[model samples]
Target: MRISSEEELSGVVRDATGPLCIRGGGTRDIGRPAPGAVIDVSGIAGIRIYEPGALTLVAGAGTPLAEVEAALAAEGQRLAFEPADWRGLLGTEGVPTLGGMVASNASGPRRVQAGACRDALLGVRFVDGAGAIVKNGGRVMKNVTGYDLARLLAGSWGTLGIMTEVSLKVLPAPEAAATLVMTGLDDAQALRAMTAALQSPFDVSGAAHGDIGTLIRVEGFSQSVAYRSGKLAQMLAPFGAVTVERDGESVAALWRDVRDLAPFRGTPGDVWRFSVKPSDAPALVDGLRRAGPVERVLYDWGGGLVWVETAPGRDLRPERLEGHATLMRASTETRARIAPFQPESAPVAAIAAGLRARFDPRGILNPGRMG
Candidate 1:
């Protein structure tokens, strides 16, 4: 079923006879497959409002992400969270939509500095499982006292509610950008280099490592970017010779590869994402290599985010963990057996269950997609 308006969507959910798989652009098919009739929200899409002067924009949840980006580009602004496009990695052929970005809380390499998609989200309008229309937060950026359900709904994977529209805070696009590349470093050295670059006072914007090299991005006015990139190169000289890439297009292309895990694209293996302390990244990689047939690995967010490609159907969760591991991509059998999201602790699990019960009393919204 397809819905073109909030009232139409609410009515559909209220009258549903069985489970419903709420979908936007369908680019991100990461979570466990939900068994139900697909409710296509792509029809309820278009920009509702945009104020470049106030750095604010509001749009339908199903608005194509490209449309939003193009509109923002024309105004010299952008979604600072740098949302990633998972089509190549997930092997799903569909345009990414605004609702999907928020639902998944999708973020890219720049998250280390600018924060995630949820951080930029100002407010949202969604329909609860009981067919009640709910609106939370505000259209402008400000602090508020109370439960921030707008952010709570984010990264919820549509389990709590189905978002119909959203308001976001945006930022002006940088005047210039450059990346300092350091090659010939192992995971440990790369982590060290990334750490140093991030800790520096030069205001680095992105830090990532993969088969290519260790990358440190600095953005600002042309002169400021030049100075920072040069200083970053000198500071990181101890790791290896630093090669600075200043061409705007080249710098963007490099980060896009890192942001999207381009190296693992089209590979024949299951993909896993690990969120841990930057200090633990190298050791985690070492342990994983020792324990299994790991194929490829990439580090983002200053080594805090680990993307691993490994043999299919393998339960890669360690006996003890400081953070969490998620099964990002896998076969139907593998996803069915191994939980796609990290299992929550007893206390946390209870809280989540209670929230689901309260928001989705009928248990009909995108059931089991998170687990």
Candidate 2:
């Protein structure tokens, strides 16, 4: 059902009295199956308010991310915690909504320093499964009165409720930024170099390494960026074969592709996102490599986030890999045959069920989307 107004949405959800699948732009339709009627929230679009000095912006749930970026750009500000642009990687259009991104807790390379979508989210207004409008958090930064319900819904993937509006913390545009590109290092060496750069006081905002090259970004004053780039290069000299590309546009373009996973686009294979200790990345990748051919692997957060694309018919079970691996993106057949997420422990599973009950007692919101 296409809900144009908030009231209409609430009424439909109340009347259904069953599970509802929240859809915005429908870019990630493949990741999770919708077992109920789809409630398209894109109709509820547009920004409500933006305050530059306060570094705050509020918009309806269906507000397009492109629109939000453009609006923030006009005010010389931006979403400090960069959200991932999955369109390029998924071979879909860049039409994701701010609510979708927040709900997914999507983040890019900047997440190493800037944090995730939950960190930038200040407030949210959503309708519960009971059709009651609930508001959590506030426009200001220091709202600690209630149980941070806003953040709870941030990465819930609409399984809890349907978000109506969101308020986010914005940041001023960086004065200057540059990326240091280091080439020809193996996964272990690249991760070491990235970790070394992150340890420095120069403040590397982004660190990502693909199979062929590693990219480090420093954002601040032009002089500071230049100085840090040089220092980072020196620190990584032991890793062998280093190249620094200092152009701002080029750096941005490179990271944009990284954030979007451009290299793995349109590949006929399954994509998985593995989260493990940064030091364990090499072993995990190597183990997976032994299992089958890996099309591409992008390491983020100094190896904490590993995006692995496997050849067709390759089974990537967490039990098979040395460390845990979760299937972030997959085809319908693959999803049916293999578990998308790693099996949670009994305690964690109980807690997750409790949380789900609190938000959606009737199990009327995106049932089994995360499972």
For all candidates, the clash counts are 0, 0
Measured by TM-score, the strongest candidate is 1
Per-residue C-alpha lDDT of model 1 across residues 8-70, encoded as one tens digit per residue: 989988898888899999898877888898999999899999999989999999999999999
Q: Which stretches of candidate 2 lie over 4 Å from their true place?
A: 320-324
**Which regions of candidate 1 are displaced past 4 Å?**
143-145
The TM-score, computed over Cα atoms with residue i paired to residue i, of candidate 2 is: 0.96
Residues 149-179, model 2: lDDT tens digits: 8889987888888998999999988888888
